[model samples]
Target: MFRPENAQSLVGLALTLLVCWLLSENRRAFPWRLTLGAVAVQVGLVLLLFGTPGAQTVVSGVNDAVDGLAAATARGTQFVFGYMGGGDQPYQVTNAGALFVFAFQVLPLILVISALSALLWHWKILKWITQGFGLLFQRTMGLGGASALAVAVNIFLGMIESPIVIRAYLDKLTRSELFLMIVVGLATVAGSTMVAYATILKAVLPNAAAHVLVASIVSAPAGVLLARIVVPEKPGQGGYYADYGSLLKYDSAIDAISKGTMDGLTVVLNISAILIVFVAFVAIGNSLLSIFPPVLGQPVTIERILGAVFSPLAWTLGIDWKEAHEAGYLLGVKLMLTEFIAFIQLGAVPEGAMSERTRMIMTYALCGFANIGSVGITVSGMGVLMPDRRTEIIGMVWKALVAGFLATCMTASIVGAMPRELFGY
Candidate 1:
């Protein structure tokens, strides 16, 4: 069995916590119980999911399910886009270049998954799962009911959609609790996007689905722990729980799917627009940077700048020093742009450019929605949900983004600390 990279993992974990501590509003009253408990929970999950045969079987099942889902999406695409959606063409070209049609493949999955999630919610299956986990968060971390529920549901729902579960309690939540909610939102990826990411990275990492699921689970508690450390709960503000009965309801099963499809379309369009604009901006920035001077006989670009800036952090996460810069570039891309772009770029990383270990570390690290753009989404979405908390939400966005970033890194460290045997290395 391959041994854990214990030294690097320890440094990563310490550095992640230290960064959170440095940014803490009240270092003296740090929630040690919550912090330690969250770490225990993350470690337990990593061992159970990565080291056990039974859990591996379940992960395989999820992978199989995702494959089926992807196939279904392909059928729908074939019906609409014809051969462009992977259907057979009348004649094949002698040397056809690969096409990157975002509309035909990537965006459609979002709509399908969103609709399925809505159907599950309508059946109350999602409610049970969310509530069960919410209760666990409440008991283990001593979180108020509303905050715990919001964090728990976030595993399945998007950040903005999750707050709707505790909408009744949003205005009443303490500043600390509200901030925790925002951090949880940024820390975890939604189910729809999670599957999309898994599909994108499937070629590079065969077990992408399992890792994404584990990342979401581990980050929830990590976010809570970091949020508590950064801004401790005030005196006389504990044990408050929102009634589960206050959840929003759908008109019917059909309504749920239809509404979900519509919502997913909006998300699809937003993602397309964001990618087009942000990617163009990056290209523009790189063009300008390239004019300055050459670096090591090559023109300086945005990727090189990001890699140089974040290489040390990547090394702490158990990436080999030689390959850390490349890994760091992916992390920086995720933070500056989006995880979707980062994953796409990751899959396209030339063979032998980095070791498999480095690729795995970057995959775990970048599996979050903590980009700069998400700050505006969280602030505005929560602002509309609870108009009174708009000012508070805006104030907490930067800190929440930092906490979310640290939380994902914490997950990476825990995974890195696992014996390579767990990853079949």
Candidate 2:
């Protein structure tokens, strides 16, 4: 028998594609070949990732490695920051939850992972993987050399950093290709943040490392699929820049470590500031909203407003109508704020408030960096890379954000389509 959630997800998938086409700049120019190719690639990848035995073993090993890395980070943090950072407590803990400090414990993983990512780039480990995927995308999806490379690299890098890998082709990329890069970049999380995200979700979701990794990898094609639909390429409009491999490099391992650590420090500081400022603003907004009368027996807070607006979108992702309002609130927070904030809030939700399956679906849906603030970050980053195309960048970015956001939803719907048996539920 066909599962009810799977049926819902299939419908959600169709609705997602329909919505993408409805917003297309040139619907007649839709690249059906790329569409089919991207979907096939995504399906094959997801199956290979979830169904294959050997792949599962590898994923398990990866999870173990991530745990090791997290442990190593804890060691480093404890030494630097004392017992507050997971070191031995000078006094007996009254409560386990009360003793855990997010800033001291979890945020430090960003520093360790960033430095390791830089070291891997220096060793060409990341470059080789990016090349293999880039070639696959270029051949299967008919993407330009630069677009293929950028999207593949984006699986492991940030929105702006991926473009840096294809810096040589930034100016030459067609408008469609440029937009695709941004969408894919926003659709996936960076490698540096993957472990940190896994750490956050590990308590709530088993095998969180693999889920985040698969979400980033699988969402690449979903981003491409939606981006192409929303802004289909016209023949003879842009040059075909094929893959030339990664141009990103560091002078040496030591240089990589230093640069990576500094980069991590920037992210750490930014996350701190963002959480502090955004949380306060949200509290202020909620306080202001309190003046209004309650609606439908609930206070009209920002989250409730967002939940009402996005509940339909959440429902379309195979979420139950009854639970969708809660899921919608999370999605709204993700789009309006950031995924970091979303994940934190998700971790805080009570156990029985949402099902384990719903949590998994939400995990994939909220994996990306697409949000209101990221538009400015992306445009400014892309603008710095290609100053002359700033106008085009500005024009296409908001649309790309929409595509990016929907791409993650598309990924979630596909995941929801699968039997819960595959996930050991």
Candidate 3:
């Protein structure tokens, strides 16, 4: 079932690693053991997650839960904002698609999921899970206690939020360890935003929530692998640090909900604000470019420009050249702008613009916090906690950004190279 064409993605995989090595501070020393282990771990995750029938069922359950959560979030929105919030419309419906309002309906899911995650954290469900992953990283990948914990936490939390859990360990980490933590953070998406993204692309990509989870988990080792290559630990640098396991504390269940909702609200506002600004910029930029002649029979808008620029890279993800333009645009938007906007555009991609397989690959590739904007966000967030290392953090962000970008790229290629039957597309 492995198409010969998929081999191109393997080339992509090799090239991605090579680029990381090329950018290495210590080119003479590559962590070959760590690199091989990392790739195997990603393949293992894809197999365990998608190759089994039981795991397929789990994927279904997760999708169902996301639908239910979206429904629940809708109820809250309707109660507060009336029909505009996806409640009954007073006017005769000419177009149902018009009724699917993103601001009113989709974005609100963040608030609910955020609160639930907080509640789970208070209950120690998430904590136990994080610790389990930390143990796995420490054992399998040779990560330090705090570094492993930070990487594990990033699977479920945001860049800054994950680092906050191991705040005490931030200053204590070696250069290589700290950079790994940042790259891992950039390479993964926050659990709080996962549902919102699931809702956005559920129509285009099957079991979208599950794939998002898959992308997040697999990117961990990829991040670790790339981080180590770019900044190899000192020859004698052994990963050891204090146990920062129970650092994310809360007063009670009620306190957790309150804190979580407030945090979600911050995310919600930040998202809303960014969308407005970015969309406006896109509009302005497109308007200015309207005077330019069309290329390939399409207008020279920002989207088309982005697609043209990123097509080759998207091709590396095993997307067909014919479909690469569309995939590239989304990839470009993700790296240059934000994943949220990219998801919105991907959801709106006209049917047949790209194959379902290409869409799935893009979903995996886009499932990260690696973008120009996030580099600054991660730097600032980590800097606030350890202001003394602000300069050092700033210096390493560029390397981490490239590592994070390539980390997600590696995940896509791995998934792309596998037989569709293996994952049951």
Tens digits of lDDT, candidate 3, 1-425: 87965897897799889999999999988988887888888998889878876987888888999999999999999999888898989889988888887888887888888889999988999999988988888888888888889999999977888878888777678899989989999999988898988898888788888888889999999999999999999966746664754598899999999999999999999899989998898999999999999887978899888988989998988888999988899988998889999988988887667678888898888999999989879777888998998999999999899999899999999999999877665
Let me know the TM-score candidate 3 reaches against the reference structure: 0.97
Q: What's the lDDT of the predicted structure labeled candidate 3?
A: 0.88
Q: lDDT of all predictions, in order shown? A: 0.85, 0.87, 0.88
Residue 393 shift from truth in candidate 2, angstroms:
0.7
The better-scoring model by lDDT among 1 and 2 is 2
Q: Per-residue lDDT for 237-338 in model 2, tens only?
A: 654565454377899999999999999998899888888888888999999999999998988899999899999989889899998999999999999999
TM-score of each: 0.97, 0.97, 0.97
Number of the top lDDT candidate: 3
Clashing pairs in 1: none
C-alpha RMSD of each candidate structure in angstroms = 1.5, 1.5, 1.3
* lDDT score at residue 266, model 2, on the 0-100 scale: 88
Superposition error at 425 for model 3 (Å):
3.9
Candidate 1 has a TM-score of 0.97
**Which residues of candidate 2, in runs, are more than 4 Å off?**
237-246
Q: In candidate 3, which residue pairs clash?
A: none
